[model samples]
Target: MRATLIPHVPETHVYPEAISVEFEREGGLLWLRFIIDDNPDFIAWPGDAPVGRADELWKHTCFEAFVTTDDGYREFNLSPSGQWASYRFDGYREGMRPADEVCVVEGLDGGRDYVALEGRIELPVEPRRLGLSAVIETVDGARTYWALAHPSDKPDFHHPDSFVLDLP
Candidate 1:
């Protein structure tokens, strides 16, 4: 699959090998997991929003996590109370717009906190253009956009250098 650029941080630095993904199905749910190695010092504060340190970690790292079934798709959001908030996407159709969601996952002790972002994407019948974008902050206060371009059918998980973030 080929990845292209969408608007994002211009100076974003990504570790190609630091990305790992897995897909599995359990009972009536389809799961996709994405783990990326991110610096703990890099925090996300949503546009002057009031967020504590722990809350910031949850907001920045946790993108989205959910389950899908043949009947439709069910999405879950992580609550500050540490509970699962659920939602359903009954409007999902074969040729409709791609479904998008974001959530945060708490890290286990001794593990570096990270973000888990996912898209319950639907590919168009014909080749449809799509962009995968992410924003990360550096310890030095620089924000960069990491994005890739690929067809909806094939998600781009390769490093930015492979095609998405090609310098040229």
Candidate 2:
């Protein structure tokens, strides 16, 4: 499945024309491909680093996925800096703890006008709904939140209504 993300507010610059996330389920693994289109000069990306787990990657340019399970939900933060974070929530923003499960990330790479992230998130269960989003920070220290759906007036990815992607 592939979906485009919209910025919370009207875009003032032409840094990025669009952002999207793709998911493919195969061999008990759910693969994620996030693409940021028309990132002029690639100024928003923080550059590459050693691939590993880290915290608060969302503070900068990053990609995120929220998968709802039987009991709770999972949040995966994939950063362009080669860091990733996975957390499990018992409820809507409740009991957030590091999932500690490692995901296979190929590292964030980009071209002249686009950036992409590819990774394999372990499928804990068959997700029925999903919230795919991103936090983009430009070289000028400006930030914009993007998501598949913005149900609230503000950028609230945890809102139940934000999980607009229904799976079969």
Candidate 3:
């Protein structure tokens, strides 16, 4: 399914004007695609170097997915720099650990006015809920958080309330 992401708050204005996230399951692999409308001043990681298991990618431009089943959830971060990482939480933000078993392949497309990022991963099983979000950094170093829903006063993707999308 495809979900259009909106800013957590209306006052936080940034580009691109529209952001959409699409996810689908094919056998055991989960496919993800992010489309960002053209925004001239959007900041993207310049280098295309291979991004190996990195921590705290949310500090920069990154696409994230929070998948939950029962009391636990899995957080996946895919950056424009070709780096990706997944962490499993026992509940909320508890028991965080690297999900090394889950391999991911990600790519970026920014040649045109708009940009697109595609990612695929092998999931252990289908998740009950999915919270999709993106952190966009601009030329001026301003950051905007986009997600399906934001229940907190501040940008908090880790909150269970942010997981608004129910999966079949």
Rank by lDDT, highest first. 2, 3, 1
The model with the greater TM-score, 1 or 2, is 2
All models: lDDT? 0.34, 0.80, 0.80
RMSD of 2: 1.9
Which residue segments of model 3 deviate by more than 4 Å?
Answer: 46-48
Query: Once superposed on the true structure, which residue ranges of model 1 sit more than 4 Å away at CA?
Result: 1-18, 23-34, 45-60, 78-83, 93-106, 109-168
Can you give the TM-score per candidate against the true fold?
0.36, 0.89, 0.89
Error of 2 at 103 (Å): 1.9
Residue 13, model 2: lDDT of 61
Candidate order (TM-score): 3, 2, 1
> How badly does each model clash, as a count of residue pairs?
11, 0, 0
Task: Name model 2 segments beyond 4 Å from true.
Answer: 12-14, 40-42, 47-50
Error of 3 at 67 (Å): 0.6
**What TM-score does structure 3 among the candidates reach?**
0.89
